[model samples]
Target: MRRRSFLASSSVLTIAALALPIYPARANEPFTEGQTAVLLRLVKDIFPHDALSDEPYLAVVEQLASAAADPDFLQLLREGMSSLDGAGEGDWIDRIEADRIAALKEMETTPFFITVRVSALFGLYGNPAIWSTFGYEGASYEQGGYLFRGFDDLDWLPEPLS
Candidate 1:
């Protein structure tokens, strides 16, 4: 009888534990595809004509936006923009373009807009898939951990010093 009661109590506790929300998935809200495109265009304008072309920036922005369907990520983005004083800048695309350029200029001596644009250029140029597509082999193997290594094989010491 005592064992049965203990088992019942444990089961209830286990169920409750499982039911608790840790990090709930963000709500699905409509994201304007046009806005995303505009942001991409602005990112491109900021950072144009890298060796890998414009693929890296486009890919990252797309991936980030897709992943940003999560409320947490979107909220973080909103917070970051606010921290950068991006309120009421304009419509979604215009605001992003204007605020991003403004932030860049305000934060650094090297024309802020150009710096971000250059950053986008470098980011896209540095992506492995983009590099692979372009037939460029610089530092290919060095970034393999993030690009290809499977989770089951992660190790700390003696990093694949190849």
Candidate 2:
């Protein structure tokens, strides 16, 4: 009985010791509730569902919002959002989306658009099942062709491009 109890206790302690490094406590990082809300709202707006399902979109938004709250991710978002605001005259997402489209047309450039576009792209691309819907084969050569491509052709492009 004593030997059994000793072995059980030692096993428990060993298991716990192994888990400690695998599950270290994350440091507390501050994030404003308002900012988080805005990010969620923006993600939902960018990827709304009609009658299919909301789970995938919601999950993507949650992941993105969590990243947005992180110090490093937040810095990148802030820079992109600030650039969007500076380039146009409205809310951050709207201005950035609009400005990005305009710049893409006028300059025939994609880097500016990519900064904002990639965020939404990532939200969708993160899910392998979602990528499969459009017949993506998951090769580097075929990756670009699988992305959302209708933004460039929106009616607003001509005016902004000119």
Candidate 3:
């Protein structure tokens, strides 16, 4: 009995010790499929781009994913995902978006939401694919500025009233 108890306790401690480092892996590692999908959905909800496809949006995800590679960030994201809570895959995106935004609003002043929101704000818009979707050909610094590039010709928008 003593030998069995000793072995069991030792095994449990060894297993726990082995598992300790795995909790906080580096942020550079690719996220699991479910995590990536959840993250992509989160980004879309935060910054909806109707004209764009999944490709461009995924680019934004990749940027955020790098940030999420940090264990701290991964924990933050996991918490945020949980905040969005148990909506089904079939649940309406609008409903999910509303709920998640509300959850985030609750944590608006916290570092996690702030970091995520700011990162998404900057990362999502800067993709060239997103720019083209909005009819922005990007900076013409070498060729001159927006005057020559027709900066105002935004194709994604409806024509203004006369």
Counting clashing residue pairs in each candidate, in order, gives 5, 0, 2
Q: What TM-score would candidate 1 get against the native?
A: 0.38
> What lDDT does candidate 3 reach at residue 111?
48
Question: Tens digits of per-residue lDDT for model 3 on 17-91?
Answer: 332221222342557777777777767766877887887557656766655555666776777666555433443
Better of 1 and 2 by TM-score: 1
lDDT of 2 by residue, 1-162 (tens): 322232234443443332222212222233355444445444544554354255555455455454445465556555544454455566545445545455334422323233223344455555565655565546554546534654365574455645
The top-ranked prediction according to TM-score is 3
Question: Per-residue lDDT for 1-162 in model 1, tens only?
Answer: 322232234443443343232222332232456544654655765564455455566664654454455565455444443344453455434555556666545644323233233334434654567656665666646777535545345566566645
Top-lDDT candidate index: 3
Model 2 spans with C-alpha error above 4 angstroms: 1-55, 92-100, 103-119, 128-162
For model 1, state the Cα shift of residue 8 in Å.
44
Scanning candidate 3 in windows of ten residues, the lowest lDDT window is: 17-26
Q: Model 1: which ten-residue window has the lowest total lDDT?
A: 19-28
